[model samples]
Target chain A: MRYDIRFSGSGGQGIITAGILLAQAAAIKAGKNAVQSQSYGPEARGGASKAEVIISDDEINYPKIISPDIVISLTQEAYNKYAVDLKDEAVIIVDNTLVHEYKQDGHKVYAVPITASVKELLGSAVSANIATLGVVNEICKIMEHQWLLDVVISNFPERAAENNTKAYNLGIDLAKKVME
Target chain B: MEKKRERKFLQGNDAVALGALYAGCKFYAGYPITPSTEVAERLAAWLPKNGGRFIQMEDEISAMAAVIGASLAGKKSLTATSGPGMSLKLENLGYGYMAEVPCVVLNVMRGGPSTGTPTGPGQADIMQARWGTHGDHPCIALTPSTVYEQFSQTVRAFNLAEKYRMPVIILSDEIIGHMREAIEVPLEGELEVIEREKPACAIDEYKPYDNSVLVPKMASFGQGYRYHVTGLNHDEYGFPTNSAKLIGLQEERLIKKVEENYDDIVQVEHFMCEDAEHIIFAFGSSARASKDAVLNLRKKGVKAGLLKPLTIWPFPDREISEYASKVKDITVVELSVGQSVREVSRAAGGRCNIKHIYKVDSKPISPVDIEKAVEG
Candidate 1:
């Protein structure tokens, strides 16, 4: 079976990077077929940007996320824009600190204060997408933690690897706490 | 292979550069154009390390000329550009075609007539890649629907160009060029690389345009062979000759060189066409979506199938013809508003109903669009 996921956020929130990481980790590191694609306005940032990733064991014919089985919305705009299109039992992930208003739309909603936690743990809000890399990994479990961590950290500078790791671990812990 | 294979998540453009490198492409002269700029970027970074040459030309015209010049000087050369740049490069491209210059021109397509959409995707260049150049000339163009195919087809492009002693176009689209996919990079020396045939005879007897044979043995510039290479119709020694008989022979030989090898040059992938009632004709990125639509239609008891052409310029007429005759109807899917559909209709020869599932707003032709066409 194919698993479709969308990671949505304002541009420069690293949503594209996260989607690339997921697809790369699944395809290159884990030896699967994966496709990641996105479309956004010509804006440099702050637009309703979104990245979609589809991973399957077999050849992926339709490379788009078909009725996203999992959605990761890092901004209010992203959440509001995409939440309505989730699959019947889709797992919806959102940054609780950013997406304040969300109607329970049949899909299970997992809210984490991703921005707040990333800022506290990593001392930077820019890496909030990296932190949610951990949250999405924990919630979706599409790839192993170590592979996903490697894929995410490798995209960043070598100097910031330790803080990103700490933030990711914190995200995993926060996800566990929310589940309980 | 002494070197181990390297696996990486790479865009198709990256693979195109690497593929040229594998095919012994020693020179790249290209302008930066969207969807295809990464090809120049990757070659810039990798070519120096591999002892190859990369030059950013002032424009696509010079880029195409530079590639031809470098190839004439005995280097495996290439240049890549997109739609508008391709339009600019066509004159020089036809020059290379006429001169029988072996080089690769990668056209990573985007919407265009005149800078239509910089960031959007389009297969509008399908016919352009084949007929953009003003004259009737034989050229090879290959399209890859996947990243792996991009690498393989890029290598094939260089091989065919050298083998045919003519220009080859790698007609990649924006979606394939920019999309990242995991591919196992072939080890150095793992793939078969074909270089141009150097003259076996003495330098005194070498002729740049020898219509005596199908593909004349080219003597690279400064190879101690005194010969002329020109865009004008040239005689056996490559001197410009307006002789009616000789010019006609040169033109016919150029076309014959490719047309005679039609079976070898034409390539297509037939997916579940044995019992297919509906055959969908597509190439490049559109074929990916069509493949899925075929599968879905099969599940719905439609017996749908896909005929994907990897070698697009030669048009794969034979395979398309055979299938079009048997299938109840044929649907041509493309990002452009009916460029390839016309070719499919012509190749089908009214044997079957030819439908077009075309998109021209620069949006990708989704499977639903193709599926709807099949249903209709």
Candidate 2:
């Protein structure tokens, strides 16, 4: 079955980059086919950024995100903007720190204290994006945790690698228990 | 040695795609539209299987934009559309013309100023093909009268596009588009296909838009050759400028490239005009009726002949003038009320009487109409 995953947040959050890493893992690492497309307005930053990734074993015809199976929102702006478009069976994952009380009626919600966890683990909230990437991997089970960790190491430059690794592991451990 | 073969049964749109593929077109970007969708469908299925790429954009504007983008990435790109879609693509076509990007745009014209007749054909876009896009930029338009010419002229379209570094339009109407006829696609390396000339000078000495050769050298985007391109009037460096002299020189250079090379770009077909007293100016499917009309008029002792355009733009102005001046009466027939008739009138120059036999009911001009026009 084809699964469409979308990562939506403000432009600086690396939400689109998270989508790209997932697509690359599915397409290049696992030998499956994937297509990733992102939408950002004319603004350089601080605007909404959304990246849609579709993974399938067969050729993909339609690339647009109609109803994503997994919708991850790192901010309140993204959650409120895209929550209504989710599939009935979709799992809506939101950051508890950025999105305090927003919830959808029929969809299951997984609230992770992503910003607070990243700040406590990595000594900064800047690694919240990497922490969310780990949460996404744990919930989707599309890629192994170790493979995602390797993806993070290879993706980030040398100086910031340790902080990202610490934040990512903390997110994976938190999502493991929260999803249960 | 094997036999040299040329036969015919193919639709004009398919022939155009075949010609483009044979000319090494590795990329095609287009949105599907009626009467022209087959070209995109065929390319979408064929290009990817052949190691090329195909993209269907959200609209014709994006389709044309992606085509220009792909061309900048060093792929020989093309797009096909009918009337409404072609209208949507004009803005991008202007950008392509101003940037001097080499590409081909096939307009398989249907009846319209709007969505007139989706399935029926018309040669009405003749004027639009020349001046549809804004500004005084030069354009090369080829009108193929037969499916065989559709294949051959498509190759010519690519050659002219690459040679002049401009978007060349292959204007095939519904008649040629839908009409299926047998056509032999020559083997690869048989047809002469001319690619764009690359820079011969050293990197430091090269100017991407240099007027020295009248044909500037182009470097593809990924080729490490740095160049800037914008739709504004600019100097040799491809920077935007408002200088009148630069604008004037660039405009003249654009026209001179096509005008001076019209001998290589313009094509026409003449039938039984030797000592004929009357002539009918026609193109696209209308020319088919004009051909038979000439036969009928000859049977009636009218001494009439047909002048069919294979090269619609550059208008065959001088050739039409020389040929029409020899005839006493010339009747211009088209699916439109009267568009190409203006060109025929100007070419005839009042030295010969001009008559316009028009049909705007979205039907092909019948030979009887041409005969009636000549008799009147």
Candidate 3:
């Protein structure tokens, strides 16, 4: 089975990093084939950025996503730009605090306070990406929760690891509530 | 004891940098450009730590010249750039060819003409790689699609340059350069690394431009073997020669070295072509889409196959000609408007119909694109 996931947000929001971590969890921890790619303007920040990750049981030939199976957007602009042409059954999770507008066109759409929750808990929205990863994994069940968390911990520095861990667990809880 | 191969998730440009280190490349001189800048960045951090030299040259021309100079001084050198930078390096690249300096030039191609798209991918440099430099000079270029091939082909690029005694170009695009994938990094001593043949004769008897052998033994500039190195056509003794016979022989020998060892220099991957009637001819990242198209077509019971050239230059004429005779038609897919298709047409020689599916809008051609072209 092939699953293509896209993460969209403004640059410097770690959208690409979230995509990479998910790919790493699948490829390295779960022993699956995965490919991750990103597209962005030539800016360090504030421009639209999107990253796509393909996880598969078989060899991946075409690297880019033809149609994403899951879409995660942190900003309304990013949501409107990439949420189009998604698969009919595609799962979309958008940040409720930042993205207030989205089409719920016969697809599973969850608007969670992703950035606000992280900011409330950790005093900053820096770990919103990790929280989003947690929410996506909980909803998709793509890999073992511990495997994904392990990959996430390995990516960040030591001092920031604790807060990121809290953010991830918070995301899982948020996602479970949404499913409930 | 079997050595362990470490698998790591690496970007394509980072893989190229690591591959260069594995191939014993000790000098890197490059000017930064998008899509290809990561190569220089990684080398800048790693090259010095590994006891190698890295220089961020002021401009692309100087970077190319510095690489050629470093290689002439007995170091395996490399330079990375995109399209405009590639254009700037062509003049010095030709010098590397004429002077027989062994170095690698990697073009992680971005969109074309003159700074067309700084961050987008393009294969327009396909023709430029083959005939970018002036004159009847021979070229060896490799196009790798996967991150693994990016690493392996880069090592191969260095080996080809050192073995052939000329500049080798790696035509990678932004997608392949920036994309990240898991790859099994070869263990040390696992891959064959070829060093340039050093002079075995007396210092005075060494001929920098020796035609007695297809590839003459090279001596380091400071190794007490003094010889002239110039872009001008010179004789065996490395002296400027106006003699028509010597100049003619010089050019022929330059071309003959690559042509004589064609099999050793050219590589291609044939997927599902055993009994296939239709073929998709592609290279670089476009080949990845072609592979997907072939598989999808096969599912629908169509006889479609993929012929991907890992070695882009020294065009795989022999392979194309043979496939043209076997296949009903071949569709060439590239990111450029139409660069490699002309070569595909020339190599097919009308034995099979040649079609083209190309894109220049900075977006990669998808499998659907290739499938539509083949079916239509």
Candidate 4:
């Protein structure tokens, strides 16, 4: 079975990196076949950026994701951009701080205070992407929470590891509360 | 022997770069273009560590020229470009054909004729790829629909370039270019690399274009076979000749080299066409959409299948003809209006009913459109 997921946000929101992390986690760590792709306009920063990930047990025959099963939006602009494309039963997780309102319709919507959670823990907005990953990890339940923490730490350099770890654990805590 | 690690996530462009490096590509010349720039960037960072060189040319023309020049200097060379860049490189592509240089050109095609949609995906370069360059020179073009095929076609492109002493174009569209997938790349020693076959004769007996085989035993520029080379019509001694006999002979040899290798050059993939009544013909990125459409058609109880041309050039006439004789109706879908449908009609020998589904506004031809075409 193919599990297609999409992350959409402005360019600086690290949407592409999040997609890469999913592909790496699924293909490398979890040993499943996965494909990831990203799209953005010419604007170097602050433009709309989207990253798509498809995970399957066998080969990925079709590369494009026509309709996504899971959607994540960190900004209101992103939520407005892809809210209409989600399937009726698709799960959507939106950032509460940046995204004020969630589209309450056929989709199962979950609002997580991603940026607020990270800002409260690290006192910075730069780690909101890490917090979003915490939400994804709990929602998907495909990989271990510690494994994602380890992935973030191992993938990042040594000096940034400690702050990233704190930000990641904060995400895990937030996600656990949401899931419970 | 034991099996190594199975699969790892790799960006499609990264796979092409790693595959080129593994195939002994030492020289890379390219101008950065979207969907294909990552290939140049990766090679720029990786080639240096492997004792190779990477040059970002001023334009696509120079990129193509530099790769041809480096290959003549006995270095395995390559260049990457997108749609507009590929158009600019067509001039040098003709030069490579006339001069018979062995090199690989990777065209990660995005939408368009004039910088149409840089970030979008389309496979509208099929006809341009086969007839892009000027003149009647022969060419080999390989189309890879999947990322796995991207890795293998890269190695195959280099191999064919070295084997036939011609430029091979790896035509990949934006969908497969930017997509990331799991690929099991072979370690350095596990892959068998094919280098160019040099002349067996001594310097005194060396003739650049002899009447031996269609492709003469080429000697590298600095390898002591110091021979005359020109794009103009020339004799076996490589000297400029105005004689009709020499020009005719050179042209014939150039065409014959690729013509005789048709059996080895033509590649196609046939889907459930054994007992099918209708056929959908497509290639490159559009082939994936056709595959989806075919699956949906079968579910609806319509006997449909797909015919994907892996080698766009030397169009698969035999397969098309045989399938046409069997199937009652055929539909051709493409990003362009009527470029490939003409060839499909000719290949079918007009034995079956033919329909065209053209989407030329730089958008992908969806399966919904295909199903509509079939019903209409």
Q: Pick the candidate with the highest TM-score.
A: 3
Model 3: clashing residue pairs? none
Q: Cα deviation in Å at residue B268, candidate 1?
A: 0.6
Q: What lDDT tens digits, residue by residue, belong to model 4 across residues B1-376?
A: 9778457577778888988987889999999998799999999999999989999989999999999999888888999988899999999998888888899999888877798888887677877888988889888988887777788788888988888888999889887888888888776667667888898787889888885667788898888887877888888878889999989999999888888998888888998887889898887678877888888899999999899887877778888999899998889988777877999999898899999998866557888788788767
Better by lDDT, candidate 4 or 3: 3
Ranking by DockQ: 3, 1, 4, 2
| Stretches of model 3 off by over 4 angstroms after superposition | none
Give each model's clash number: 0, 6, 0, 0
Tell me the lDDT of model 2 at A42.
Answer: 38
Q: What is the TM-score of chain A in candidate 2?
A: 0.92
lDDT per residue (tens digit) for residues B1-376 in model 2: 8876554334567778888888888899998876788789888888998879999989999999998988877788999999899999999999999898999999998887898788667778888889999999888998887666778888888888888899999998876775444456788778898877776576777688886668888888877677788998988888888989888888888888888987888888888888788888888778877887888789888999888888888888887788766888888988887888888888778888898898877667777777998999
RMSD of each: 2.0, 18.9, 1.1, 2.0
Write one digit per residue (lDDT tens) for candidate 3, span B1-376. Answer: 8777988988999999999999999999999999899999999999999989999989999999999999989999999999999999999999999999999999999986998888788999988898888999999999999999999999999999999999999999999998988999999888899989998788878888888789988998888898999899999978899999999999999999899999999999999988889999988889999999999999998899999999988999999999999888999999988888999999999999999999989899999989999988
Flag clash pairs in model 1. Answer: none
lDDT (10s digit) by residue, model 1, range B1-376: 3676778898788889878888888999999988789999999999999989899989889999999999999999999889999999999989999989999999889886898787678898888888889989886789899988889999999899899988998888888888888888987667788878988788888877888899988888888888888899989998999899999999999999999998888889999888998999988889999999998888889999999999987888888789877989999998877788888888899999999888888778878778989999
User: What's the true lDDT of residue B256 in model 4?
Assistant: 86
Where does candidate 2 chain A have its weakest 10-residue lDDT segment?
Answer: A58-67
Interface RMSD of each: 1.3, 19.9, 0.8, 1.9
Q: In candidate 4, residue A71 scores what lDDT?
A: 88
Better of 2 and 4 by TM-score: 4
Residue B319 Cα positional deviation in candidate 1, in Å, after optimal superposition: 1.4
Deviation (Å) of A180 in candidate 4: 4.7
Name the top lDDT candidate.
3
As for candidate 2, its clashing pairs are: B8-B182, B8-B183, B9-B181, B9-B182, B9-B183, B10-B181
